[model samples]
Target: MDFNPPPYQGTNRILGGKSVTMQDVAEAAGVSISTVSRVLDERLPPSRSKAAERVRKVAQELGYRRDIMASSLRRGGTGTIGVLVPRLSDMVMALVYEAVFRAAERHGYFAIVATSGDDPAQEQSAAESLLDRRVDGLILATSRLDDQLPAQLRQRQIPHSLILRTDGVSRSALGNDEQGGYLATRHLIDLGHRDIGLLAGPNFTSSARDRQRGYRRAMNEAGIPVREEWVCESGYGIEAGESVGYSLLTRENRPSAVFAINDDLAIGVMAAAHRVGLQLGQELSLVGYNDIPLVARLPIPLTSVHVPFDHVAALAVELLLAPTEPSDPIRRVMPTLIPRASSTPPASS
Candidate 1:
């Protein structure tokens, strides 16, 4: 039996079979190996600008790739970050994770993500798996209000930060859900919508509770009674939203407007409206949270609260990389409202 590897492709393989190294680049550029290393690693002093430029050009032409694992080991770090989210199938989580991955690359760190299906037990298991892989830190976007994983991470002295959701006991980088809810409700109220229904998310998550509070506050400030029947707790998906929206919209005295806590729920509400023969922004004004890309491309552009996933991800990464004391405060990012064709004054029925 013979064992051999395949030939390298492109310019990466050079020097008659061996991969290009700093020594080859240094010799070609007429500079010492240390100078070549400094130039390639971008650690050269300002006095060596010409030499650095020459070395960089030579290295690029030779297709010299640095060994990231060796460099990380030299620095006593893994140069890898782990991310945990509910599931990538959720567009919101996928977009957030995309931002995390991009930000990690910008910081010269690799990011690996895993799904926990929003289950605390699954989250713990996934987190343990990430730790076993020797990740330098973690970014969690699967926290419930009563989750103990953040505490456990703290006990273990792991460098971690929470995104999208938080337990309020950990360093978190998340949008201001209460403010987003308030903004969504207030937009409806300002448009003369007195009766508003809410398709709130599950109560276990702080985001759901906070958004509900904001809705209540907005309605109360406008002197509009929040009908208990109009407020339905829903799962974070289109199916749950559709089921709840159908029940609410079919009622004899259904609210003229509905505010869904997420785009998925909003989409479900739209489906229910179609079934109920209600025209959005006319017979029934609707608003959604998380101004995902699909919302604007909808037949009727959705009014939504825009939570900047990139900003949240960047901040979460920064917090995870930062050396912070146990007493460091949690961080919150504010959201903005993006009005579109889906929200308007209630139609005269």
Candidate 2:
């Protein structure tokens, strides 16, 4: 007899042997379907060694493969997660996405990335689109916590979690913003600069606002009054920092020390100061946050706060994946300050 070529296996297509199902594997292993599933997913704890071994043996014999898509579909899911972040261009946000993607993959789910361009309206639209596509859960870095988007997600009973940030009047796991602020400020202050200036970020973002608050807290604690005129407000880009940094430095007898909300803004401030022939860490001491990849490499090294993205990202994923009620979303992580070459005591103090 001639041997036939291996046939494709699907609903209609026939292979030489019968297709293996969960029930078939369970019967072969002498266990329940759920046991087979648990074994296949390795979901059972180490205590269930004998049970796992039996299921693994049967699966190996039958070449049983659990079709994740079919499983998710049967359970009314797409096994896909929606991730909404501010912008992929932001290094910090990108790191968060990478971690979330890896976490989702391990759980047999696909991740879809969306950007809201820092607009509430854009975030809503992105969320709606994700929902329409039937994602199993959502990981959002764009959440304002108490914003309408969170409210809407709650009303719909959607599975969503915040990463990099949490909704609250107070800062959460993403950082010890107050402490970071204090460290940055105290670093400048300790360097003998009393009249420090804060080149702030977009006031609308809670993260940005917190840094400003942190600056104030440190100064207040030090008994040094914050020069209100020295604090310059700006938005989220290099240009924002440049304009704010330049304007702040040039407009008044300028602050001898400057603290920026993030590394990008700090870099901008550095560039602007360079244009005016002011040496960093000499005449002016500068501090920044989000010690990104370029911090150490910059022409003038950066003194900034390091928010551990890996820890925060993993925590966010763990929280999202946990089978828990809506009791309370926990605040999980915090940022640390890293002093670099760019900061020093001002000449006049």
Candidate 3:
């Protein structure tokens, strides 16, 4: 039997049946290990030097691949960001995650996400799992007004940033919910609707509470008394919206306009209005928050508050990677109001 090996053909050729390393490529290309590392780093700008070209060629011939884990460890980071969301099934949550993903990529980091279902225990478990994987930092989207997770992370000296909501102590990036709420309600007021009902989401979240405050401020500014019964406490879901919407519409003193803090709730309210034979734009003015894409395509397009999720995501990543704690712990992005067919001046106007 002839004992001869074939020439290397630019494939993953193991030497002594061991994986190829940067040292092997450096030796073959007549360069230092540091040079090989710098040239192979995808985060850096590619070099056009002759040695770089030779190093590339030698690396290909030796079938050498960079070990991202070892590289990141040496650089004191994992090159990954872990993101925690309430649930990916919710459109707003999904959108926020997508924005974070893009922002992470722009900062030369990869993002991994896990759902917590808005449960405290689940959120704690999921965050631990991400930390166990050695992610460099975390971005949380399931923060609540009374959440203790942020405090725990701070005490442990973990690098983390909160998004969408906050506990008010940690680094956070979110839309100005109060301003968004005011814009939505004030739009209805400008349409000559005095009796404007509100579909307020649960009070566990800072967003819901701030939005409710904005609603009260708007109503008070217009010299209108906010009917305690008209401000229905509901969940951030379509079903909850429908239930509250039905009750409000059935009452003899129903409002001419309504503002739902969430787009899902607004959609549900629309269904309830249709069920009661009410004409959407003519009889009931509705405004929703988040300006989800589905609302724009409805028969009567929804008026909504458009949140700049991308801006918030970028700010969250910046806060997470800041060299020192920023003086401003919480960053709030402004939102714009989008008018559509669903809101119009009352017939009496």
Best by TM-score: 1
Candidate 3: residue 104 lDDT (0-100): 90
Which structure is stronger by TM-score: 1 or 3? 1
Steric collisions counted per model: 0, 4, 0
Stretches of candidate 2 exceeding 4 Å from the true structure: 1-66, 169-173, 326-328
List runs of model 3 lying over 4 Å from the truth. 1-67
lDDT of each: 0.87, 0.76, 0.89
Give candidate 1 regions above 4 Å deviation.
1-16, 24-61, 326-328
lDDT by residue for model 3 (1-349), tens: 8532222212245777777877788889999877877776665678999999999998887778665556566678888999999888789999999999999976668899999987899999999999999999999999877788999999999999999898889999999999989999999998899989999999899999988888999999999999999999999989999999999998999999999999999999999999999899899999999998899999899999999899999999989989799999899999999999999998778
lDDT of 3: 0.89
Instruction: Give every collision pair in model 2.
Output: 145-167, 173-333, 175-335, 176-335
Task: Write down the TM-score of every candidate.
Answer: 0.88, 0.81, 0.83
The best candidate in terms of lDDT: 3
lDDT (0-100) at residue 306 of candidate 2? 87
- For 151-221, candidate 2 gives per-residue lDDT tens digits of 67767778777776667622223665666777788888787888788987877666777788889998998
CA RMSD of each candidate after superposition: 6.7, 7.1, 7.5
